[model samples]
Target: MKKKNDENVLATNRQARHNYEIEDTIEAGIELQGTEIKSVRAGKINLRDGYVSIKNGQANLSNVHISEYKQGNIYNHDPLRVRRLLLHKKELKRLAKEVDQDGMTIVPLKVYLKHGFAKVLIGVAKGKKNYDKRESLKQKELKRELQRNFKLNQF
Candidate 1:
Protein backbone atom coordinates (compact mmCIF):
# COMPACT_ATOMS: atom_id res chain seq x y z
CA MET A 1 0.00 0.00 0.00
CA LYS A 2 1.20 3.51 -0.72
CA LYS A 3 1.97 5.76 2.23
CA LYS A 4 0.87 9.38 2.63
CA ASN A 5 4.22 10.33 1.19
CA ASP A 6 3.21 8.54 -2.01
CA GLU A 7 5.73 5.75 -1.67
CA ASN A 8 4.91 2.08 -1.75
CA VAL A 9 7.79 -0.12 -0.74
CA LEU A 10 7.96 -3.22 -2.88
CA ALA A 11 11.19 -5.02 -1.88
CA THR A 12 13.96 -4.37 0.62
CA ASN A 13 17.47 -5.73 0.85
CA ARG A 14 17.61 -6.61 4.53
CA GLN A 15 20.95 -8.36 4.23
CA ALA A 16 22.52 -5.19 2.85
CA ARG A 17 22.48 -3.49 6.23
CA HIS A 18 23.83 -6.59 7.99
CA ASN A 19 26.76 -6.89 5.60
CA TYR A 20 27.56 -3.28 4.80
CA GLU A 21 27.85 -0.05 6.74
CA ILE A 22 25.89 2.41 4.65
CA GLU A 23 27.57 5.76 4.27
CA ASP A 24 24.91 7.47 2.23
CA THR A 25 21.77 6.74 0.29
CA ILE A 26 20.32 8.17 -2.92
CA GLU A 27 17.06 7.55 -4.71
CA ALA A 28 17.24 6.83 -8.40
CA GLY A 29 14.58 6.05 -10.95
CA ILE A 30 14.64 2.63 -12.60
CA GLU A 31 13.84 1.91 -16.23
CA LEU A 32 11.61 -1.13 -16.44
CA GLN A 33 10.01 -2.88 -19.36
CA GLY A 34 6.22 -3.09 -19.48
CA THR A 35 6.03 -6.64 -18.13
CA GLU A 36 8.75 -6.03 -15.58
CA ILE A 37 6.85 -3.21 -13.92
CA LYS A 38 3.79 -5.42 -13.69
CA SER A 39 5.77 -8.12 -11.91
CA VAL A 40 7.24 -5.51 -9.58
CA ARG A 41 3.83 -4.16 -8.67
CA ALA A 42 2.78 -7.72 -7.83
CA GLY A 43 5.66 -7.91 -5.31
CA LYS A 44 7.65 -10.40 -7.35
CA ILE A 45 10.82 -8.32 -7.21
CA ASN A 46 13.91 -9.17 -5.16
CA LEU A 47 16.57 -6.63 -4.19
CA ARG A 48 18.71 -8.90 -2.05
CA ASP A 49 21.55 -9.39 -4.52
CA GLY A 50 21.31 -6.09 -6.35
CA TYR A 51 24.15 -3.60 -6.64
CA VAL A 52 24.74 -0.45 -8.61
CA SER A 53 27.63 -0.01 -10.98
CA ILE A 54 28.55 3.26 -12.63
CA LYS A 55 30.00 2.90 -16.08
CA ASN A 56 30.35 5.24 -19.01
CA GLY A 57 28.92 7.99 -16.83
CA GLN A 58 25.74 6.03 -16.27
CA ALA A 59 24.45 4.00 -13.34
CA ASN A 60 23.27 0.46 -13.89
CA LEU A 61 21.43 -1.83 -11.51
CA SER A 62 22.69 -5.39 -11.63
CA ASN A 63 21.58 -8.77 -10.29
CA VAL A 64 18.11 -7.61 -9.22
CA HIS A 65 15.34 -10.04 -10.09
CA ILE A 66 11.89 -9.14 -11.23
CA SER A 67 9.86 -12.22 -12.01
CA GLU A 68 7.91 -12.55 -15.22
CA TYR A 69 4.31 -11.40 -15.10
CA LYS A 70 2.15 -14.50 -14.99
CA GLN A 71 -0.09 -13.07 -17.70
CA GLY A 72 2.72 -11.80 -19.89
CA ASN A 73 3.34 -13.47 -23.25
CA ILE A 74 6.42 -13.66 -25.50
CA TYR A 75 7.56 -10.10 -24.83
CA ASN A 76 8.10 -10.67 -21.11
CA HIS A 77 11.26 -9.05 -19.82
CA ASP A 78 14.27 -10.99 -18.58
CA PRO A 79 14.10 -11.74 -14.87
CA LEU A 80 17.75 -10.89 -14.08
CA ARG A 81 18.47 -8.27 -16.67
CA VAL A 82 20.73 -5.37 -15.75
CA ARG A 83 18.60 -2.25 -15.74
CA ARG A 84 19.61 1.38 -16.06
CA LEU A 85 19.19 3.80 -13.18
CA LEU A 86 18.41 7.46 -13.83
CA LEU A 87 20.39 9.98 -11.83
CA HIS A 88 21.52 13.53 -12.43
CA LYS A 89 24.97 14.07 -13.83
CA LYS A 90 26.28 15.47 -10.57
CA GLU A 91 24.83 12.64 -8.52
CA LEU A 92 26.21 10.09 -10.94
CA LYS A 93 29.67 11.63 -10.75
CA ARG A 94 29.52 11.70 -6.96
CA LEU A 95 28.48 8.08 -6.79
CA ALA A 96 31.23 7.05 -9.17
CA LYS A 97 33.77 8.88 -7.06
CA GLU A 98 32.50 7.37 -3.84
CA VAL A 99 32.78 3.86 -5.27
CA ASP A 100 36.40 4.41 -6.18
CA GLN A 101 37.42 4.54 -2.54
CA ASP A 102 38.95 1.41 -1.02
CA GLY A 103 36.40 -1.20 0.03
CA MET A 104 33.54 1.11 -0.93
CA THR A 105 30.69 -0.06 -3.14
CA ILE A 106 27.15 0.78 -4.14
CA VAL A 107 24.34 -1.49 -3.02
CA PRO A 108 20.63 -1.27 -3.60
CA LEU A 109 18.83 -0.88 -0.29
CA LYS A 110 15.23 -1.06 -1.46
CA VAL A 111 12.82 -0.81 -4.35
CA TYR A 112 9.72 1.27 -4.06
CA LEU A 113 7.09 2.96 -6.14
CA LYS A 114 7.03 6.72 -5.77
CA HIS A 115 4.41 8.75 -7.56
CA GLY A 116 3.75 6.01 -10.10
CA PHE A 117 7.42 5.61 -10.95
CA ALA A 118 9.69 2.75 -9.94
CA LYS A 119 12.65 3.87 -7.83
CA VAL A 120 15.61 2.21 -6.20
CA LEU A 121 17.34 3.45 -3.08
CA ILE A 122 21.02 2.91 -3.53
CA GLY A 123 23.60 3.23 -0.79
CA VAL A 124 27.26 4.02 -0.68
CA ALA A 125 28.53 1.34 1.65
CA LYS A 126 31.60 -0.27 3.04
CA GLY A 127 31.60 -3.95 3.96
CA LYS A 128 31.62 -4.43 7.71
CA LYS A 129 34.26 -6.50 9.38
CA ASN A 130 33.32 -9.63 11.36
CA TYR A 131 33.88 -7.78 14.60
CA ASP A 132 31.77 -4.88 13.45
CA LYS A 133 28.92 -7.23 12.56
CA ARG A 134 29.08 -8.91 15.95
CA GLU A 135 29.12 -5.53 17.68
CA SER A 136 26.06 -4.41 15.77
CA LEU A 137 24.24 -7.60 16.75
CA LYS A 138 25.10 -7.09 20.38
CA GLN A 139 23.88 -3.50 20.25
CA LYS A 140 20.62 -4.61 18.65
CA GLU A 141 20.02 -7.22 21.32
CA LEU A 142 20.70 -4.68 24.03
CA LYS A 143 18.26 -2.25 22.47
CA ARG A 144 15.60 -4.92 22.22
CA GLU A 145 16.05 -5.85 25.84
CA LEU A 146 15.77 -2.25 26.92
CA GLN A 147 12.61 -1.79 24.92
CA ARG A 148 11.07 -4.87 26.46
CA ASN A 149 11.97 -3.76 29.95
CA PHE A 150 10.54 -0.33 29.35
CA LYS A 151 7.27 -1.83 28.13
CA LEU A 152 7.07 -4.07 31.18
CA ASN A 153 7.60 -1.14 33.50
CA GLN A 154 4.94 0.89 31.74
CA PHE A 155 2.29 -1.52 32.90
Candidate 2:
Protein backbone atom coordinates (compact mmCIF):
# COMPACT_ATOMS: atom_id res chain seq x y z
CA MET A 1 0.00 0.00 0.00
CA LYS A 2 1.14 3.52 -0.74
CA LYS A 3 1.98 5.77 2.17
CA LYS A 4 -0.36 8.61 3.02
CA ASN A 5 2.58 11.01 3.09
CA ASP A 6 2.77 10.93 -0.68
CA GLU A 7 1.09 13.88 -2.39
CA ASN A 8 -0.54 13.69 -5.80
CA VAL A 9 -0.73 17.11 -7.46
CA LEU A 10 -3.93 17.66 -9.44
CA ALA A 11 -3.61 21.21 -10.69
CA THR A 12 -1.21 24.13 -10.45
CA ASN A 13 -1.66 27.86 -11.11
CA ARG A 14 1.38 28.72 -13.20
CA GLN A 15 0.03 32.19 -13.85
CA ALA A 16 0.03 32.99 -10.16
CA ARG A 17 3.82 32.83 -9.98
CA HIS A 18 4.24 35.02 -13.06
CA ASN A 19 1.67 37.64 -12.02
CA TYR A 20 2.36 37.79 -8.31
CA GLU A 21 5.44 37.67 -6.11
CA ILE A 22 4.63 35.13 -3.46
CA GLU A 23 5.86 35.98 0.04
CA ASP A 24 4.58 33.07 2.10
CA THR A 25 2.62 29.85 1.57
CA ILE A 26 0.26 27.79 3.68
CA GLU A 27 -1.39 24.42 3.17
CA ALA A 28 -5.08 24.20 3.94
CA GLY A 29 -7.68 21.48 3.56
CA ILE A 30 -10.51 21.90 1.09
CA GLU A 31 -14.13 21.21 1.95
CA LEU A 32 -15.01 19.16 -1.10
CA GLN A 33 -18.33 17.44 -1.72
CA GLY A 34 -18.66 13.86 -2.91
CA THR A 35 -18.78 14.61 -6.61
CA GLU A 36 -16.21 17.33 -6.24
CA ILE A 37 -13.70 14.95 -4.77
CA LYS A 38 -14.33 12.51 -7.59
CA SER A 39 -13.63 15.17 -10.16
CA VAL A 40 -10.56 16.34 -8.32
CA ARG A 41 -9.16 12.83 -8.18
CA ALA A 42 -9.58 12.59 -11.93
CA GLY A 43 -7.37 15.70 -12.29
CA LYS A 44 -10.18 17.83 -13.69
CA ILE A 45 -9.34 20.93 -11.71
CA ASN A 46 -8.19 24.41 -12.77
CA LEU A 47 -6.53 26.82 -10.36
CA ARG A 48 -5.29 29.37 -12.87
CA ASP A 49 -7.95 31.98 -12.12
CA GLY A 50 -8.62 30.97 -8.54
CA TYR A 51 -8.04 33.18 -5.50
CA VAL A 52 -8.48 33.05 -1.75
CA SER A 53 -10.69 35.46 0.14
CA ILE A 54 -10.87 35.89 3.88
CA LYS A 55 -14.34 36.73 5.12
CA ASN A 56 -15.71 36.77 8.63
CA GLY A 57 -12.47 35.23 9.82
CA GLN A 58 -12.92 32.37 7.37
CA ALA A 59 -11.09 31.66 4.16
CA ASN A 60 -13.04 30.85 1.01
CA LEU A 61 -11.75 29.65 -2.34
CA SER A 62 -13.36 31.30 -5.34
CA ASN A 63 -13.16 30.99 -9.11
CA VAL A 64 -11.56 27.56 -8.97
CA HIS A 65 -12.98 25.17 -11.51
CA ILE A 66 -13.49 21.49 -10.80
CA SER A 67 -15.21 19.77 -13.65
CA GLU A 68 -18.22 17.65 -12.98
CA TYR A 69 -17.88 13.92 -12.56
CA LYS A 70 -19.23 12.23 -15.65
CA GLN A 71 -20.60 9.35 -13.66
CA GLY A 72 -22.52 11.69 -11.40
CA ASN A 73 -26.03 12.47 -12.62
CA ILE A 74 -27.92 14.86 -10.36
CA TYR A 75 -25.19 14.67 -7.74
CA ASN A 76 -22.72 16.68 -9.79
CA HIS A 77 -21.28 19.76 -8.13
CA ASP A 78 -20.96 23.24 -9.58
CA PRO A 79 -17.69 23.73 -11.43
CA LEU A 80 -17.16 27.31 -10.23
CA ARG A 81 -18.63 27.11 -6.77
CA VAL A 82 -16.96 28.88 -3.87
CA ARG A 83 -15.50 26.31 -1.52
CA ARG A 84 -14.54 26.76 2.10
CA LEU A 85 -10.90 26.32 3.11
CA LEU A 86 -10.04 24.70 6.41
CA LEU A 87 -7.39 26.56 8.37
CA HIS A 88 -6.52 27.13 11.96
CA LYS A 89 -7.81 30.19 13.79
CA LYS A 90 -4.32 31.64 14.20
CA GLU A 91 -3.47 31.06 10.55
CA LEU A 92 -6.73 32.63 9.42
CA LYS A 93 -6.06 35.71 11.53
CA ARG A 94 -2.57 36.06 10.11
CA LEU A 95 -3.78 35.73 6.55
CA ALA A 96 -6.54 38.27 7.18
CA LYS A 97 -4.05 40.77 8.55
CA GLU A 98 -1.69 40.25 5.64
CA VAL A 99 -4.45 40.74 3.09
CA ASP A 100 -5.52 43.96 4.80
CA GLN A 101 -2.19 45.45 3.76
CA ASP A 102 -2.20 47.36 0.51
CA GLY A 103 -1.19 45.35 -2.57
CA MET A 104 -1.13 42.09 -0.60
CA THR A 105 -3.53 39.31 -1.56
CA ILE A 106 -4.00 35.58 -1.24
CA VAL A 107 -3.90 33.24 -4.21
CA PRO A 108 -4.34 29.55 -4.65
CA LEU A 109 -1.04 28.13 -5.86
CA LYS A 110 -1.90 24.46 -6.31
CA VAL A 111 -4.35 21.72 -5.44
CA TYR A 112 -3.33 18.19 -4.50
CA LEU A 113 -4.38 15.12 -2.62
CA LYS A 114 -2.61 14.38 0.62
CA HIS A 115 -3.55 11.61 3.01
CA GLY A 116 -6.72 10.89 1.07
CA PHE A 117 -7.92 14.49 1.41
CA ALA A 118 -7.82 17.45 -0.92
CA LYS A 119 -5.40 20.21 0.09
CA VAL A 120 -4.70 23.59 -1.39
CA LEU A 121 -1.47 25.53 -1.22
CA ILE A 122 -2.28 29.19 -0.67
CA GLY A 123 0.23 31.98 -0.97
CA VAL A 124 0.47 35.52 0.29
CA ALA A 125 1.46 37.52 -2.75
CA LYS A 126 1.84 41.02 -4.12
CA GLY A 127 1.21 42.00 -7.72
CA LYS A 128 4.34 42.28 -9.83
CA LYS A 129 4.92 45.16 -12.20
CA ASN A 130 5.36 44.62 -15.93
CA TYR A 131 9.05 45.41 -15.64
CA ASP A 132 9.43 42.79 -12.92
CA LYS A 133 7.73 40.23 -15.13
CA ARG A 134 10.06 41.03 -18.01
CA GLU A 135 13.09 40.74 -15.77
CA SER A 136 11.94 37.34 -14.54
CA LEU A 137 11.43 36.12 -18.09
CA LYS A 138 14.88 37.31 -19.03
CA GLN A 139 16.38 35.52 -16.03
CA LYS A 140 14.61 32.30 -17.00
CA GLU A 141 15.87 32.51 -20.58
CA LEU A 142 19.39 33.16 -19.39
CA LYS A 143 19.22 30.14 -17.08
CA ARG A 144 18.00 27.94 -19.91
CA GLU A 145 20.78 29.14 -22.20
CA LEU A 146 23.38 28.47 -19.52
CA GLN A 147 22.06 24.94 -19.01
CA ARG A 148 22.16 24.28 -22.76
CA ASN A 149 25.74 25.54 -22.99
CA PHE A 150 26.76 23.41 -20.04
CA LYS A 151 25.23 20.33 -21.65
CA LEU A 152 27.08 20.96 -24.93
CA ASN A 153 30.39 21.32 -23.07
CA GLN A 154 29.83 17.95 -21.33
CA PHE A 155 29.60 16.08 -24.68
Candidate 3:
Protein backbone atom coordinates (compact mmCIF):
# COMPACT_ATOMS: atom_id res chain seq x y z
CA MET A 1 0.00 0.00 0.00
CA LYS A 2 2.91 2.34 -0.46
CA LYS A 3 2.63 5.29 -2.80
CA LYS A 4 6.30 6.21 -3.01
CA ASN A 5 9.27 3.88 -3.33
CA ASP A 6 11.58 3.49 -0.35
CA GLU A 7 14.25 5.56 -2.05
CA ASN A 8 11.99 8.40 -3.07
CA VAL A 9 12.79 11.57 -1.17
CA LEU A 10 10.04 14.16 -1.21
CA ALA A 11 12.02 17.12 0.04
CA THR A 12 15.30 18.05 1.71
CA ASN A 13 16.68 21.11 3.49
CA ARG A 14 20.29 21.40 2.45
CA GLN A 15 20.64 24.58 4.43
CA ALA A 16 20.14 22.60 7.61
CA ARG A 17 23.38 20.76 7.04
CA HIS A 18 25.22 23.92 6.11
CA ASN A 19 24.06 25.88 9.11
CA TYR A 20 23.81 23.28 11.83
CA GLU A 21 25.81 20.41 13.21
CA ILE A 22 23.33 17.57 13.53
CA GLU A 23 24.10 15.47 16.57
CA ASP A 24 21.13 13.15 16.35
CA THR A 25 18.40 12.28 13.86
CA ILE A 26 14.94 10.84 14.43
CA GLU A 27 12.18 9.79 12.08
CA ALA A 28 8.67 10.84 13.00
CA GLY A 29 5.28 10.67 11.33
CA ILE A 30 3.44 13.74 10.15
CA GLU A 31 -0.22 14.67 10.29
CA LEU A 32 -1.46 15.54 6.87
CA GLN A 33 -4.81 16.09 5.23
CA GLY A 34 -6.01 14.37 2.05
CA THR A 35 -4.94 17.11 -0.33
CA GLU A 36 -1.69 17.58 1.50
CA ILE A 37 -0.60 14.03 0.77
CA LYS A 38 -1.34 14.54 -2.90
CA SER A 39 0.75 17.67 -2.87
CA VAL A 40 3.55 15.87 -1.07
CA ARG A 41 3.48 13.03 -3.59
CA ALA A 42 3.83 15.60 -6.35
CA GLY A 43 6.97 16.91 -4.62
CA LYS A 44 5.41 20.25 -3.87
CA ILE A 45 6.92 20.78 -0.46
CA ASN A 46 9.69 22.88 1.06
CA LEU A 47 11.60 22.14 4.25
CA ARG A 48 14.22 24.89 4.11
CA ASP A 49 12.39 27.27 6.39
CA GLY A 50 10.65 24.72 8.56
CA TYR A 51 11.33 24.08 12.25
CA VAL A 52 9.81 22.03 15.02
CA SER A 53 8.92 23.70 18.26
CA ILE A 54 7.50 22.36 21.46
CA LYS A 55 4.32 24.11 22.43
CA ASN A 56 2.13 23.07 25.31
CA GLY A 57 4.09 19.84 25.47
CA GLN A 58 3.27 19.05 21.84
CA ALA A 59 5.64 19.00 18.91
CA ASN A 60 4.39 21.12 16.04
CA LEU A 61 6.14 21.66 12.75
CA SER A 62 5.78 25.18 11.44
CA ASN A 63 6.64 27.13 8.29
CA VAL A 64 6.82 24.05 6.09
CA HIS A 65 4.96 24.73 2.88
CA ILE A 66 3.00 22.07 1.09
CA SER A 67 1.54 23.52 -2.07
CA GLU A 68 -2.14 23.19 -2.85
CA TYR A 69 -3.18 20.20 -4.86
CA LYS A 70 -4.03 21.14 -8.42
CA GLN A 71 -7.13 18.96 -8.45
CA GLY A 72 -8.13 19.78 -4.93
CA ASN A 73 -11.64 21.11 -4.38
CA ILE A 74 -12.91 23.57 -1.78
CA TYR A 75 -11.78 21.33 1.05
CA ASN A 76 -8.13 21.91 0.35
CA HIS A 77 -6.11 22.71 3.45
CA ASP A 78 -4.16 25.86 4.11
CA PRO A 79 -0.77 25.67 2.44
CA LEU A 80 1.23 26.74 5.53
CA ARG A 81 -0.71 25.41 8.46
CA VAL A 82 1.21 24.04 11.44
CA ARG A 83 1.34 20.26 11.32
CA ARG A 84 1.60 18.01 14.34
CA LEU A 85 4.42 15.49 14.56
CA LEU A 86 3.71 11.99 15.84
CA LEU A 87 6.32 10.88 18.37
CA HIS A 88 6.30 8.94 21.58
CA LYS A 89 5.76 10.91 24.76
CA LYS A 90 9.17 10.01 26.18
CA GLU A 91 10.91 10.94 22.95
CA LEU A 92 9.11 14.23 22.87
CA LYS A 93 10.20 14.96 26.41
CA ARG A 94 13.77 14.10 25.54
CA LEU A 95 13.70 16.41 22.58
CA ALA A 96 12.19 19.14 24.70
CA LYS A 97 15.04 18.82 27.16
CA GLU A 98 17.64 19.05 24.42
CA VAL A 99 15.95 22.01 22.82
CA ASP A 100 15.68 23.73 26.15
CA GLN A 101 19.44 23.83 26.44
CA ASP A 102 21.40 26.72 25.02
CA GLY A 103 22.30 26.62 21.34
CA MET A 104 20.25 23.51 20.67
CA THR A 105 17.28 23.40 18.31
CA ILE A 106 15.25 21.05 16.19
CA VAL A 107 15.21 21.15 12.42
CA PRO A 108 13.69 19.05 9.71
CA LEU A 109 16.32 17.45 7.51
CA LYS A 110 14.13 15.67 4.97
CA VAL A 111 10.71 14.32 4.20
CA TYR A 112 9.79 11.03 2.60
CA LEU A 113 7.31 8.20 2.69
CA LYS A 114 7.76 5.08 4.75
CA HIS A 115 5.36 2.19 4.34
CA GLY A 116 2.62 4.36 2.82
CA PHE A 117 2.90 6.89 5.62
CA ALA A 118 4.41 10.34 5.44
CA LYS A 119 7.53 10.58 7.57
CA VAL A 120 9.90 13.41 8.43
CA LEU A 121 13.51 13.09 9.50
CA ILE A 122 14.37 15.65 12.15
CA GLY A 123 17.70 16.43 13.71
CA VAL A 124 18.88 17.72 17.04
CA ALA A 125 21.29 20.38 15.87
CA LYS A 126 23.62 23.01 17.17
CA GLY A 127 24.30 26.10 15.10
CA LYS A 128 27.65 26.46 13.41
CA LYS A 129 29.66 29.63 13.73
CA ASN A 130 30.85 31.55 10.69
CA TYR A 131 34.42 30.28 11.05
CA ASP A 132 33.13 26.74 11.40
CA LYS A 133 31.29 27.03 8.10
CA ARG A 134 34.42 28.33 6.37
CA GLU A 135 36.48 25.48 7.83
CA SER A 136 33.95 22.91 6.66
CA LEU A 137 34.03 24.38 3.19
CA LYS A 138 37.81 24.20 3.13
CA GLN A 139 37.71 20.55 4.19
CA LYS A 140 35.20 19.78 1.45
CA GLU A 141 37.39 21.46 -1.14
CA LEU A 142 40.42 19.47 0.06
CA LYS A 143 38.48 16.22 -0.20
CA ARG A 144 37.38 17.05 -3.73
CA GLU A 145 40.94 17.83 -4.74
CA LEU A 146 42.18 14.53 -3.28
CA GLN A 147 39.50 12.61 -5.18
CA ARG A 148 40.37 14.40 -8.41
CA ASN A 149 44.10 13.66 -7.96
CA PHE A 150 43.35 10.01 -7.26
CA LYS A 151 41.23 9.70 -10.40
CA LEU A 152 43.93 11.27 -12.57
CA ASN A 153 46.64 8.95 -11.17
CA GLN A 154 44.51 5.90 -11.97
CA PHE A 155 44.17 6.90 -15.63
User: Which number leads on TM-score?
Assistant: 1
Assess candidate 3 and give its lDDT.
0.94
1 or 3: which has the higher lDDT? 3
User: Each model's TM-score, in the order given?
Assistant: 0.96, 0.94, 0.94
lDDT of 1 by residue, 21-88 (tens): 99999999999999999999899998888888999999999999999998998989899999999999
- What lDDT is obtained when candidate 2 is compared to the true structure? 0.94
- Write down the lDDT of every candidate, Cα atoms only: 0.93, 0.94, 0.94
lDDT of 3 at 45: 99
Question: Judged by lDDT against the true structure, how good is candidate 1?
Answer: 0.93
Give RMSD to native, each candidate: 1.7, 2.3, 2.8
The parts of candidate 1 lying over 4 Å away from their true place are 1-7
Q: What tens digits encode model 2's per-residue C-alpha lDDT throughout 76-103? A: 8999999999999999999999999999
